[model samples]
Target: MLSPGDTLSDFTLEGVDENGEINTFTLSELTDDAVAVLNVYVYDYSPVCTDQVCDISELEWLGINEDVNVVGISGDGPYSHQQFIEDNRIGYPLLCDTAEEIIEELGVLHEEKDGLRRVPQRSIFLIDSDRVVRWKWVAEDNWDEWDSGPIEALNDTISQIRA
Candidate 1:
């Protein structure tokens, strides 16, 4: 998996914007002039993934840090991401990685039991304005959620990084 201090390569993806419009975006554009929290998940509407995304959406620190951009990326397609956003009232953009290119590049790709399905291992990346990864968290298994408490712990980490 990508580690802290590693520079991220730029990649383009089609995603559901905060306004619910599907548009193509590049990593540089997303992180421009700000730090970004990239939440990489297995699937769009899965139980743990839903909890993780919602917790992030409800983060109080998000209101305080205008320079921090939080986005979720998953192997689901743009339509699925759009529906997930609308259904959950998610506040941030969610990127589609249908081709699995981004997840493979980040070393978080996972294959299902049937060996016909692939997805990302639940992961998070804190990338600075310069595209250097500042911090990261990768779940050991697909079911593993945040250990230090969900929203508050993640908020604290982002807070410390900004500080």
Candidate 2:
């Protein structure tokens, strides 16, 4: 896992824009915002994963922190991500890791189900403007069970940044 102050590697991924158009997004473009919470999930429809991403969207700090950005990522295709975002009314951006390149780059690709590729692990990375990892968390066994008090954790990280 990456630690605070570690520079994130340049990675490219395919995602769907708000207009539902296929687009390629690079790490550089992603970190161009103020702060980003990169939530990596296993699949689109999974229970735990959905809660993690959706609840994060409802985090109150995001509305107050103008410089904060958040994006959910999964190995699924853009079409699936698009529909999932729409159905769930996901307010933030979702990245379609169709090629699994970002997952591989982040060293989280898992070989589950004998031959199928599964999400490496459930984790969230807080990246700062300079592309340095500021904080992170990894779910033990299931993402749904992972809880650090969303608002509290986010508040702590943001407070640290402000200090």
Candidate 3:
């Protein structure tokens, strides 16, 4: 339930590299001087989640946005994430949160229908250099429509921040 202007908590997350090696990173360490496009999904290989993240990867401007970094996050382990990345041909990093620490910290984890804790909803957060969430999107159900509006809003916010 974090909102715009809310400062993010300290989080040390593991992200896999191109070679599928695990790399540890912290939120405070990575947020400085950068804009992050964060996608928190329910599972690694789920259809809706994969489509959402892969579509994000297809955003042409992301590769050229030197000030921005695109990262997808899930509670899955690094191995599963590695496979997902390779299968999906994801060009960006897939953050590993096997224990769902970040998800629980962000208050997104909830009781799922399958008897396990799944990220309650698909949400996106646009965090600016200062580590404040500038844009956010939340969906209650998998069928919820979340288009590129968050990205557009993020671009607008980034422009304003630079101005």
Candidate 4:
């Protein structure tokens, strides 16, 4: 798993922007001028995932933090991400990892019991403008109840980094 201080390489992926348009975006583009919070979730509309994204989207500090870019990544496609953004009023861009390449590379890929399905393990990575990871949190177990503390911690970390 990627840890704090590891440098993340730039990668391109299709993402649904805040305006609900699908576009190709590279990691460098998102992090070049700002710190980035990479929120990796299991699925778009899954109950916990929905709550997770919504919590991040509604963070008050995020509205004022132009220097922090929060981007979500999941195996769902662009159409799903667009609907998710519209349905939940998500303010951040959600990238599609349909190929699972990024998820696997980040060591967050989760496989199902049946061995037929794979998804991203719920995780978050904070990367600074230099592409070095400053913080990382990965779920210990996939089915654990959702916790809002991590999101708050992420916000606090962003503030500390920019301070």
Tens-digit lDDT track for model 3 on 1-163?
7888887777888887545677886776667777777888878878778888888888876778777777888877888888888888887888888788777766677777776655646888877777888888777786565566766776777687668
Instruction: Estimate, for each residue in 56-163, the C-alpha lDDT of model 1 and write its tens digit.
Output: 888765667788888899878888988899999998999988898888988889787679977788888888878888778788888865454544555666678667
* CA lDDT of every candidate: 0.83, 0.75, 0.77, 0.88
Q: If both were scored by TM-score, which would come out higher, candidate 3 or candidate 4?
A: 4
- lDDT winner between candidates 1 and 3: 1
| lDDT ranking, high to low | 4, 1, 3, 2
Angstrom error of the Cα, residue 71, model 4: value is 0.7
- Ten contiguous residues with the weakest lDDT in model 4: 140-149
Model 3, residue 48: displacement in angstroms?
A: 0.3
Q: Judged by lDDT relative to the true structure, which candidate is superior, 2 or 4?
A: 4
Better structure of 1 and 2 per lDDT: 1
Query: TM-scores across all candidates?
Result: 0.89, 0.84, 0.87, 0.95
